[model samples]
Target: MSSSAAGRPDDPVAALAELTEAQRQQAMRRWRLLRPHLEDGVAITRLAAATDASPRTLHRWLTAYRNDGLAGLARRPRADKGRRHFPADLRLLIEGLALREPRASIATVARQAAAVARDQGWPIPSYATVYDIVRRIDPAMATLALDGEKRYRDVFDLVHRRQAERPNQIWQADHTQLDLWVITPAGRPARPWLTVIQDDHSRAIAGYAVNLGAPTALTTALTLRQAIWRKSDPGWHVCGIPEIFHVDHGSDFTSLHLEQVMADLRIRPVFSLPGRPRGRGKVERIFGTVNQMCLSQLPGYAPRGTRDRAGRAQLTLAELDTAIGTFIRTIYNHSPHGETGVPPQQRWESASFIPRMPDSLEQLDLLLLTIAKPRKIHPDGIHFQGLRYLDPILAAYVGDSVVIRYDPRDMAEIRIFHTGHFLCRAICPDLANHTISLKDITAARNARRRDLRAQLRDRASVVDRLIEAHQVPDPMPLPPPAAPAEAPPVRRLKRYREE
Candidate 1:
């Protein structure tokens, strides 16, 4: 530790970065004003007249500059800036009124306070004084007392933001109803929900799903399944099971199916506390980015409060999905992230660690498929959702309960599991030739039911009209003449003995 090796103390003049913009501007102004006098020996009285500042103020600034360097030239804050000269009880009273529910305005508080002061023989506080006192009260304290504890925590409480040590250590998933409207298969415009799962460490999207329906447990499972398996795209390298899966307290995220999947895969599920979204901030941020950078450029980009957004829709859901996928792979994945300062793909790969993968795609599907419904094989086949599924092996499993898992995107075939073992894929003969989604089936079923109900109501209305038109209310007494003659009773026979 020789003198040469010792670090030099920081120069206050050189530490301009530490000063705020206002302070820096003030300091520069003072230096410029005083430079003429210091460099060229100009008189302070003349400088003061030209700059509108008094000679005495200029002399003080000069003295400070010489004694403490450039930092001393900035405007000095008052030592008693926030302190109030009020009695303890009066101070507490003012703060109490300010913190009360249905918060009073400064004028109202001052007026009420003045009346109290007059009655108690105390000094009355002015509006400015009341406003100052209110402003000085701790914001967290005011919010808790006025708004609620929840608001206080959301605004003031420290959020322990999660950080993954490695690429596959943690992941976050969330669903957002995309701002864009797209044309559905029925030729109707509808908004789609997007579910995304991203690697927490690299901020790279692992997988995403887009659909023209509200996100459900099945959507979450499908997204998770896609995220866990290795992607076909060469650029998307993020894969494997995460040690912790962070999500909000959404029903889809908290589903029993997802819980079982995470348990079996050795992944811990971390749910944010109810009404606290700060824990999922990392994943939430990407939604905004996608909306701003990607969807904003596409057709039917109806953000919040867009007029006639449905009519503007031109792209189909499939087209929007493809566009989103392209944007993710080309722009978002390759672009440098603000927080990480590296492209997500690059950062994910920088670790050079092999992602932990499931044994096979079939095994992953078994765990990650959307819904597991228990169905008993009938003599004909397995009946599900008004559709019959048939397989040669189902004949042997007739009258036995088995679990079936299927992708909602394609309901033509379902993988059957009996006794926790993979049985066989059973296909619906009606849906074998073409693909139909669970949503489509549900929509069609609802439409049919609505049509039937409407027809029934119409027919009932017609029948009521016909009966009303042909009725004669005064002739109803004739019904008494319709009684028939009574017949003889037969002998009773004891069918059983007392034995």
Candidate 2:
């Protein structure tokens, strides 16, 4: 290499950029602090304020650099170097205090050490010296002593960023507890949970579930269901069975139901090592965006510490669900992502390759909702939790026990399985027309009570108005004649969810 090109002092920054991050950080810290002196003839007072170091210390570093090139800018070692020597007790005290369970500040330890030194008639170490000693201690030692092994690994662990070459090759699923609190079904303020499945290639949120409860295998399965099935909205076309399901080491991801479903579909499940979630960075990044972009604007956004009135809870879980749906579709999916530099929706749809999919939506529903229950088929119908389901196919299975699967949110129908084979979908006579949840029924009852009380209030006003108009009420007037009644006509209702 030529003399001019051999990492000359004039281009130290250019040379520094070529080094690794750790080495660059150490070198840059010294270079930045000393740059003002080398380039501009700046004042000591200005340099002190800029670097937060004493003038004497700045001069010392400048002298060191001029004498020994870039290497001299580093801190000078003691005669014992890494080992403890003169004022050994003080050095030990500072490092011990730094690595204590509940860490002590340099100033605090310096003051305490001064007190002990006075009693022992020994020299008291300055705060700066103590600070330098603590700062130089091995980072691994500090992490292990203060935050433990888990944190040490979290901070210093080696990670490989992995992604699929194309969409549907691999998918990532994970859950995050949102920062905003929403009103639960029980009418209490609670944080809602979110489960999202993303394409490893495009970083698109293929499917998501927002609920005010702990994440379960059901939620993940349902999310996977949405991801695999074609969407009604044409804009959202990211559908297909994924070749690989990548997820963290969560119980919800490792459930037997998920295993069975994946096995049946031939989709492999890849779990990140337990307590080391480095591979989940892509999903984690999405969650961070949600916290910053979506939750921050929400009504009940709870940030760290001093929970003031600004974070007052307002939206219910249902309302939040609608909000989340709108945000995901309109904003998040359409916006250009930081990593991919393209809108996730556009990226997902840009490809022409067909994704592998299930034969039918029914087959998907049967596999995903694994809440199967064994029930006996009676002559009248199949009996379930307080509801009787009827279907012509059940007539043949009368007096026989069959397994049934249902969605708790809707008890309008249940899928029946005879001897591990799908028989037919049986409908509940009363709730056949509309999907009904137990919570909805409870809410309806409350609403009905409210309406009756409102009617009573209206009647009271009517009585008061009549009394004011006629003090001597001319004995209540005769009721009007009844209208003619015709024979009630019989009409068949529309079949629910007709195929």
TM-score of 2: 0.67
Off by over 4 Å in 2: 1-93, 111-124, 304-312, 430-499
TM-score winner among the candidates? 1
Clashing pairs in 2: none
Local accuracy of candidate 2 as per-residue lDDT tens digits, 322-437: 77777878888899988789999888878878999988887888555765788998866887778888876665566898999988667888888999998988889788885445
Q: Estimate TM-scores for all models.
A: 0.71, 0.67
Against the true structure, candidate 1 reaches a TM-score of 0.71
lDDT of each residue in 1-499, candidate 1, tens digit only: 1223323335865656677889989988998998888777789998998997899999998877776567778887899987767677787888888888798888888888888888888888898888888889998898899889889888899988878999989899998999998988899999999999999999999999998888888888888888999989988888998999988898988988889888989999888888887677888899999999999999999888767688889999889989999999999999999998999999999999998999888788865565579999886678988998877666556689999888767788988999999999988979898544566545655665677799999999999999999997885566566678798997888788962
lDDT against the true structure, per candidate, is 0.85, 0.79
* All models, RMSD in angstroms: 20.5, 26.6
Clashes of 1: 0
How accurate locally is residue 76 in candidate 2, as Cα lDDT from 0 to 100? 43
Clashing pairs in 1: none
Top model number, lDDT: 1
